[model samples]
Target: MATRLNPYISFAGTARQAMEFYKDVFGGTLNMSTFGDMGAPVDADGIMHAMLETDSGYTIMGADTPPGMEHRAGTDMAVSLSGDDAVQLREYWDKLSASGSVQVPLEQQMWGDTFGSCTDRFGVTWMVNITG
Candidate 1:
């Protein structure tokens, strides 16, 4: 097995929903474990960890903030999706931007590629770039 690095997002209490939304957009298998499942003292239903592995070789992991942990917004981080497949990337952009706020509409950028950004309903930021 090779070492890999992937994004791990933190949510106040919406880890489950955010991970589910990512699965819908990316078409992947989602595995989630909650605090209760692990017999943790935190909210039983709150997600301890959720991982989405996509067919596109994208792995996204996330978790809900445990009880008593502070969740700060605008964390200066964004989950970025970049590839040469315009069609697939656009599909993801559409679904992800549907109910979220678009920071940049998907369009040709000055750098000569299709690029866009948005902050999801869960307050997680995402950037999608499709190479030309």
Candidate 2:
């Protein structure tokens, strides 16, 4: 089987709620396991891991809040867009990031490609890396 990259999100004690919300939004089959199943006493009720495999061939993995961890919201993630079709992906970035904050404007960078970071209208941070 070919190797694939998937997004693994970390949540602060809300893995089940967050995964369920994602299942509602993306319409996917969610498989979850608890830490207790892994013989973790402190983390027994917490989600050890959860994965959402969507119908559109997207795989997203997430886990619940770790023991005694603090969540620094809005500072820890990036929804990345990476593909060969530079034009199409740029268009998507432009549309999704419009009316939002643009941290790094989309432009040719020193890496010999275009890259940018922006926060969407819904306050989600996104990173678009357009590779040649």
Candidate 3:
């Protein structure tokens, strides 16, 4: 397979819930592995890795922050979804901004597109852009 760039999020003991939320939002097949599955001494139920491959061809991976690592949210990056599929993109923006804080409402932008940004309930930042 060719090298691909995918967003991988790190959660603090909430990886399962966060990943499941993404599955609901993006309509995808989610595969997960736990610490126990990898014979780790940490919380057995903690997510070691989780991958969601959406029908829209989006791939998101996430995991519980390991014992020695820090799980920082919304400090450095944002996940962006952009395309000409207005209907589909609007649907995503609705679901994502429903329970979270909307940094920017989804509306027509000066760039000639509908754009918005929000922080999902899981504290992940998402930016959606729908081209005209």
Candidate 4:
């Protein structure tokens, strides 16, 4: 195994729904553990940890906010997807921006690449860049 860096999101009791939504968007295998699985005296159905590993080699991890933690809903960070695969990237962008707010429409950017940013329905910000 090698070292890796990925996003670990904290949701306000919506980790299950959000991770499921991401699985649909990225077409991945999702493995989730619940609070009850860890013997924690919380909502049995609440996700303690969830991981989505996509065919595109993307790994997304998340969980419901802990029993005594704050979950803020804003873009202090954004997950970036960049590659030369235009079709796949566009497909991802379409699905991600659907039913969500688009901060920037997907189009050619000043940097000479196709770029866009949006907040998914789960309130997670994503930046997609298609390189030529």
Candidate 5:
């Protein structure tokens, strides 16, 4: 499969509604997954994990609060950048993380790719994925 980049958002408990609203606005197909089915505890079943892929090639991912976790609302969004162009992505990651806090240092991950998370200088959280 080809690689892609998408936005992954976090919600308190309205992920389903939010994703649905996005579907209506963007005109896309919504695929949802409940936490419980994906190895989450029973309490997380109510939270929604969804993805919307529009016909125009837009893709968005999102998930609601996890079990035993408190939702910090406004600080819950993430910009997910992913693709097979490892060199360019790594360069971007290095530049972005140079002056910011590296929450997850860029390194070869178990999934056979380079992945990392960081909070940029502007306070926006970002995740970079470079496929191996």
Candidate 6:
């Protein structure tokens, strides 16, 4: 199998919801495992790990901050999505910006591309760039 590099996000306690929201945005199959499933004494429903694999071959994995772990928001990390497909990328921007804070509106950039940045409702930062 070929090696792949994907983002692994960490959530405070909303990994399940965040992963589900991503599934809606990217149209993918999500497989999740919880602490209880792993025989951990943490919250039964707290996600231990979740992976979302989209049809576009995008893979995002995430997990909740396990017990005794501190979750700090805005730690200089952002998940970036970039492609030449304007329609798909715009759709993602719309969904991601809804109910979230937009740091940069999706529009033409000086570099001749459509770009935007936002923090999702779950506090995960995202950047979407669409090539012109």
**What tens digits encode model 4's per-residue C-alpha lDDT throughout 1-132?**
889889998888899999999999899799999999999987888999999999989999998988778779645678999999999999999999998999999999988999999999889999999995
Tens digit of lDDT per residue, candidate 6, span 1-100?
7899888998888899899999999998999999999999868899999999999999999999898988986565899999999998999999999989
Tens digit of per-residue lDDT, candidate 2, span 52-129: 998767787888767888755447776777766787667767775776799999888898878889875544577888
lDDT preference between candidates 2 and 3, better one: 3
lDDT of candidate 6 at residue 33, scale 0 to 100: 98
Task: Summarize candidate 3's per-residue lDDT along 19-130 as a digit string, tens digits.
Answer: 9999999997999999999999879999999999999889999999998887788667799999999999999999999999999999999989999999999899999999
**Alpha-carbon TM-score of each model against the true structure:** 0.94, 0.60, 0.96, 0.96, 0.51, 0.95
| Residue-wise C-alpha lDDT for candidate 1, range 52-82, written one tens digit per residue | 9999899999999898988875465798889
Question: For candidate 4, what is the lDDT?
Answer: 0.91
When summed lDDT is taken over every stretch of 10 residues in candidate 5, the lowest stretch is 40-49
Query: Residue-pair clashes per candidate, as listed?
Result: 0, 2, 0, 0, 0, 0
Whole-model Cα lDDT of every candidate shown, in order: 0.89, 0.76, 0.92, 0.91, 0.75, 0.92
Q: Which pairs in model 4 have colliding backbones?
A: none
How large is the C-alpha RMSD of every model relative to the true structure? 1.1, 4.9, 0.9, 0.9, 9.9, 1.0
lDDT of 1 at 99: 89
Q: Global CA lDDT of candidate 5, please?
A: 0.75
Candidate 5 lDDT over residue span 71-114, tens digit each: 67537577777888787677767766776799998999998988
Stretches of candidate 2 exceeding 4 Å from the true structure:
81-132
TM-score of 1: 0.94
